[model samples]
Target: MTTAPVRSRWEEQRSFDELGRPLRDVTFCVVDLETTGGSVGDGDRITEIGAVKVRGGEVIGEFQTLVNPDTAIPAFIAVLTGITNGMVADAPPISSALPAFLEFARGSVLVAHNAGFDVGFLRHFAREQDLPWPDFEVVDTVKLARRVVTRDEAPNHKLSSLARVFRSGTTPNHRALADARATVDVLHGLMERLGSLGVHTLEELQTYSSKVAAAQRRKRHLADRLPHAPGVYLFCDDQSRVLYVGTSKDLRKRVRSYFTASETRSRIGEMVRLASSVTGIECATPLEAEVRELRLIAEHKPSYNRRSRFPEKVTFVKLTREPWPRLSLVKRVLDDDADYLGPFSSRSAAESCLAALHETFPIRQCSDKFGRHPSRSACVLAELGRCLSPCDGSVDSSTYAAVVRQLRDALLRHPDDVVELVNAKMAALAEQERFEEAGVHRDRLASFVRAAARTQRLTSLTRCPEVVATRRDDGGRWCVHVIRHGRLAAAGVIPSGVDARSYVEQLRVSAETVVPSIGPIPAATAEESERILRWLELPGIRLVEVDGEWTCPVRGAGRPHPSTATS
Candidate 1:
């Protein structure tokens, strides 16, 4: 017979015997519970119990009992769990079953998966029954599996998970006897892995533990310092060139979390080396801060931003008041003719703004060009009072166009005007002794005020009627602008990797989307295009020389803009 080792509680807790040397000793209980879906409270009781006793990594005894839950099993649980009301009808109550379990598990560590849920039921049971809750140290095999199992390499980590890990394919009975035995099997599997990792010392095993009690105290200190509010945050390098920008509902507390440094791959430490200091921009609400943070990150594309998208490179509602007036997002900038509505930070942002405008001004944003679609009556939005109903013929083209213009001016050019108008109305209401009505206007005005304030505007853009975007423009570099009205909407550069002249279809794919002709102005005539030709004397900017053809110069190298480049 293979003689198994024996263990005492002190060996389980301390690893070393009185000899002061490492002893492979531990006392563990593989425990399982069957409950009335059963209650510890309100007269609910345990339906069954099963457990195995293991010491020094050897199972020496087993225990099992069925307790009357004193009630019907919940229908859903009964169907899935295979444990029915009849099995517990003649069994002992929890009062008797629990004592047997305590005697069997004396002086051993408990092991379970998702341990807290099972433990909580027992804790509540004891509290309700006026019994002192049983206490024992525990090790969650689930958390242990997380550290040892090679995620995809292992099939799973449930009792069945461990079964497969160790090829201990004991058929799953799920009965108290079967589950208790499976748990014993699981503990053995963990011991094998733990032994393989040379985890003989109690101190060593504790180091890798996912102990909740210890982690909670540490988190408490971290939370006390983090401000519970809304704001923007910055991760900066030593020189203060922002590496990443973020906004949160809370300021101080979010920044404070990095110092705990418990896990290597968590939030703060991953980005800490790139951060020398933190900066913040506080906003009154999460909504406003989220919107602004998006816009700022897009415009800056801070090097350390983990998120994969940019702001200014967005789809927007471009309103054009030209040959035939209408609204839609333009994807090109042929020869600037109409004004522009956005370089909105996102397509959703653009759409949401359009929805708001539709409610206020009744503008159309659809692919069907003006007068192109027949049966020119009001669109669906008109019936909802969200639109002016220009398509349905309820409103004429001139009136529709005027409303579109007002919305265009309000969103892109001057948002403050809407705020001013609402504020004026609110003031008049207060003067007329209509205080309640005035309050409504006051709230509406605040929204407009905040919206206007949130958008970080590029100043004095009105002077440049024809907006320009220049990015090397060698067949490799593409300069594009998506415009709104007759004025500049948004402009930027995109470096296409292909050579300038070859594969012209893909090469000419406009980074520029145009809306209503803004008519190209002298300022946008590509002074650099002319200057580069004069200096380099090359035909079309040569971004790359591919297959004997020329491409844009800025393509593929992933170089930063001149402004962001270090000297």
Candidate 2:
């Protein structure tokens, strides 16, 4: 009996591995296009296309096709390319030639002398023709030459100059096939020079040719240990303190990019400079990677992580459980029966929502807690008719409770009442030409509705004790997620032929035991739950099992209120 190969938790066989495919293993389709004009936006059309597919310095195949431009070829263009309208009249149209070219060039890095002109025309044509453009890795021979050959070796990095400098066997002319052939030679020549500089892999060559700073490029070794899988990465300083935290589908590619020009953020550059090492935590799925990143960032509070590090600072608008209930902004949610409407991003946002609630309800605004039988004097808000003055028994407990019930309904069950009230108030203000005051009410109403919607959305998921879902990824594997009380407890992937339901149960058994906590986000941070909710809502996600009813309120703040829809 044959034993299966054991896979490490931190390792997975990826099509594109950590070290990247060596230059010899990379297949390149050196392509050239003869166009009617320089700009696709100027209604340019491809007259001819030529491509030479090469691997390990050997030409495997060649593609050459004349395309009918469907218009008159300019006399100057005809003179340049040695092809006339007559020559292409019998040739295939771009609709045929383009697809054939794409099929031939598929799964190979595209190369061209002036890549912008050649690739741009092809991309524009594909888009205009409603063709799905493949994400092809492109290499420009001119760019490679500019990096490899100096001014002493070549005056300019143009195709003709590089062709002469490299002593290419094929001479570049205006024709597509000949120029494509010459670019192939130029590409190989540049690769040879790059190899001397220790750039043997496709990834290294691309980075070395890019505008990435030398200092940053030297730090590429830090990503060598990372696996090419979905996960979180922590950039730690010499003291082992995490300086930054991030996540990506491919850990090696993402972490390696920080040392390239692609990572342009100034703060991130400084963080990368200070980083002494990188620690990768590979996860089973992208969702798990994201959740892990969030948890780690919150735990470490890495200085370079600008967001998701201070979920504790998120504020919630609460309905205090006092004799005279009032809307108050609080940081944490407890198991108390008092209603809540937040996890708002800021105190000001929660306050604005509270203002909107007070505007619509005659609830007490006093910060002081009142006894059931109060002897204290009423506050200024009571005198202004904004409060029911429960402090002085101006409103009885039952009557005040009824108002609070309506407020809670507006916040949790239905926001129609609040929406109508705020809209009417704003409309009245606008009628008096008080546009600024109307705008203020509008902003307040927006804040209130947004918080209500967000809270309802979160609560819908958190209320469920357990949820197991699966979605088929592009790779034909079932990505399973085990969630408990809104937190991602566990995640895994099931092979195409395996029973997803059985795998889901296995994942559930191994999932983190999350205890239900108070508030909308029961086990995870509001941000983490929100991300999970979004993933759950995406099309094609199948619920394997749900322990409780997973639902949102019909008329709750989850739906857009008509009055605040535009706002």
Estimate candidate 1's alpha-carbon lDDT, on a 0 to 1 scale.
Answer: 0.51
- Candidate 2 lDDT over 324-372, as tens digits, reads 7888888888889888888888988888888899989998877876589
TM-score per candidate, in order? 0.34, 0.85
Candidate 1 lDDT over residue span 339-396, tens digit each? 5544444565555445444435555555555562336666666666765554555666
The C-alpha stretches of model 2 lying farther than 4 A from their native spots are 1-18, 42-45, 65-107, 127-132, 334-336, 368-385, 389-394, 425-439, 460-482, 491-513, 519-521, 538-549, 563-567
Model 2 scores a C-alpha lDDT of 0.85
lDDT of 1 at 560: 23
